[model samples]
Target: MSLAARAVLVHRTTEYEELLARHGTHGQAAFFLAARGRSVEEVRERHERTSRALAEVTAAVPLKWRRAQVERADLDRFLFGPEDVVVVVGQDGLVANAAKYLTGQPVVGFDVDPGRNTGVLVRHRPADAHRLLPSVTGVRTAVDDLTMAEAVTDDGQRLLALNEVYVGAPGHQTARYTLQAPSGPAERQASSGVLVGTGTGATGWLRSLWHHHSSPLPLPAPTTPHLAWSVREAWPSPDSGTGHVAGLLAADETLRLVVESDRLVAFGDGMESDALELTWGQSVRVGVAEGALRLVG
Candidate 1:
């Protein structure tokens, strides 16, 4: 940390103004990190607008735009200097990936969807980020609850999502896949597709299905524990058909379900995976990530 460095504000177009007004002050030099994916002109215009707005408040306050072509090292050099506090206001994906790379620093993410911002925020370290997430920033809405936003991946590595990760053919037709689990075995399902939901994913498509486990049951206190024994156990149905596990289904990284025999393919967070493939006799591991991203609620 350096005396020259103060707080950094990372935001999309909708959030640029208020964030500046909140953090930019007399002594603090506000550093701005721009979002990626927009055209160069658009980015420049936004940067100019943000800079101008900050100037109106205090001309001496240095509000500088991190150049659009800036790389990860550039983020390191410019954003996280001593005494610098980083404020992220856009997508979390970019934020998480960037947070994963950052060094010692204090960071506060302002927006709700940090996942989509990975294109810009992937340069920081995840452990360094803390959520100062707000429900409303001057009428710009943000999801304050973790459930409204996508689930955080275990190890804070990725987003938890199952409904959007279906496997099947293209066109107006629906895709299908076979479902299997270690304890439950296999079952052939027919519909738009099959979904594998984590506790975070329970509210969406998985909520509509009958067989999926919604969430882990809360345990009773140690002193209140009753003598419980199972006389007979009933389990879900078994099947021989094929289907795809929806939500963040990374092939090699998440799980590797057998798809070689059924022409199965995996899609993750609604995008096709080049890393994962279906194979025979391969046990597919799917569940919640190693941890959860806590919501303010």
Candidate 2:
């Protein structure tokens, strides 16, 4: 028998929820925020908005469809099926948080608090769910296939990120590795870390890095099947070279790195908890992921 379509609502825990968990009561949470010159009321209001939006989206799911909900914290443990339609109701980051776990699933993003969020990814609202759901599930709506970055370790571990991937030491210490660009001779280097990002990530950390240093390569457009990579704070020494610091990667190309340090980590979309660890001499390849984010309007 064919599997039934499922609507998976994904969201992150609001600040109000975290405050309550930390302080144990509304009054205590309020007091904690007050001491920091912030208002708990504002946090509570945002939480309520997200909660209401989630409820509306959940109710909008077709009666014949199966439904499931996964918080951002539990995404690593959640299982996403091929017949699932993901509905993300939160800020743009929440959408990125769920993207790595999905494989060509049609994603509907809702910006619950448009005034506060930039809403680049979560462009729709709760009320639009009623109209959008049918088109999405029917595969009749226009979907933007946003490019993503992928990192694969030699041992067969793989990670995908909608925004970008960071490969380096777990903490502040500098990471040592051999750098090899798509079309260049490999060179040994010691530096902070390496970052590889997709066009969907151009406006984020990649932009910040670009601002400090100029590059000949152009940043990819949101749906472009390309990647941009850079080495952060590459240290120059007689034993290390900085010639291969930054470059652009074509869809068919990849940037390679062989870890020279005791240990290194590869993480996507800023979720450090769900990361792949690499030891010395292990090689990692960063490139464009084959699957794109099927973002539904």
Candidate 3:
């Protein structure tokens, strides 16, 4: 790491703020919560805990290095330096949200509710950030480079995913597409969607899908370099086939999908808000990303 390197903190909007944004007013937000037998105080408490965690993280970064902070929703607008050390202060999922925008910058994930969190990605606690921040920049420190998944459209729009990428109809309606693996013949299919998950994501959505399989398959480790692709709820029909429902994408291979429907969408790490849209006759290639997350625990 360079002496001029800085710390970039990735923050997420609290649940209360989201409710306020959705309702347009505090009173309306509170009423909606009350109807669900919840209270504003509960949301406020959660926000307060996150606030204190952020304060700890903010104070822990060295004053010699410049600091930058951005909310998860505004990640695309932020400019990350090559020497920046990214700090994610939220749940584990927030770390995944930040990973897509980063290009090999060392990431330190701190769990806001450490005691309650059983997450694998966000391993550090709020109180330990002070010690962890310096370690990430230490000369002798080594970080793990975790594999990431990606989706590239025929027209060249690309998206990186730290966990998994969902490719399918916007509303998850039956997806009509032709799936082609590196060495297999293309097969038309109708399904809810296709999920391409990295090794780190196997413990997440991929795990649930794995549980449904009659014969269990080996789930990848966090640092596995390949991607696992699966079709969700495939339905075999006159025009659709299911022979190519699951496969592994080696680092050098591409899993291609030719769209046969009116429209299909692709999004990474469950963030549907930022997605790529594909129309009929379009194609999307799924593969391992060249830029992986350099994570420090």
Q: Please tell me which predicted candidate would have the highest lDDT against the true structure.
A: 2
Lowest-lDDT window of 10 residues in candidate 2?
A: 131-140
Q: Ranking under lDDT, best-scoring first?
A: 2, 3, 1
Clashing pairs in 2: none
Q: Given candidate 1, what's the lDDT at residue 248?
A: 34
Tens-place lDDT digits, model 1, residues 1-297: 325434455443434444456557412213334233334344345556545433332222234412122232244344454444445434443243234223434434433333443322223322323222222121343222221112222223233332223433332134333444433455444444333433333333444442243223321111121111010112223633433223333222333233324333433344343213443333333433332222221
lDDT of 3 at 157: 95
Q: What is the TM-score (0 to 1) of candidate 1?
A: 0.35
lDDT of each: 0.34, 0.91, 0.88
Q: Compared with the true structure, what per-residue lDDT tens digits does model 2 show for residues 1-297?
A: 988899999988998999999999999999999999999999999999889999998898988899999999999999999999999999999999999999999999999998888888999989988888867867468889999999999989999999999999998479999998978799999888989999888999988887767886789998999999888989999999999888899999999999999999999999999999999999999999999999985
Model 1, 74: alpha-carbon shift in Å?
A: 15
Show model 2 residue runs off by greater than 4 Å: none
- The positional error of residue 112 in candidate 2, measured at the CA in angstroms, is 1.1
lDDT of 3 by residue, 89-153 (tens): 99889889989988878899889987677757788888997787877878666678899999999
Candidate 2's TM-score reads 0.97
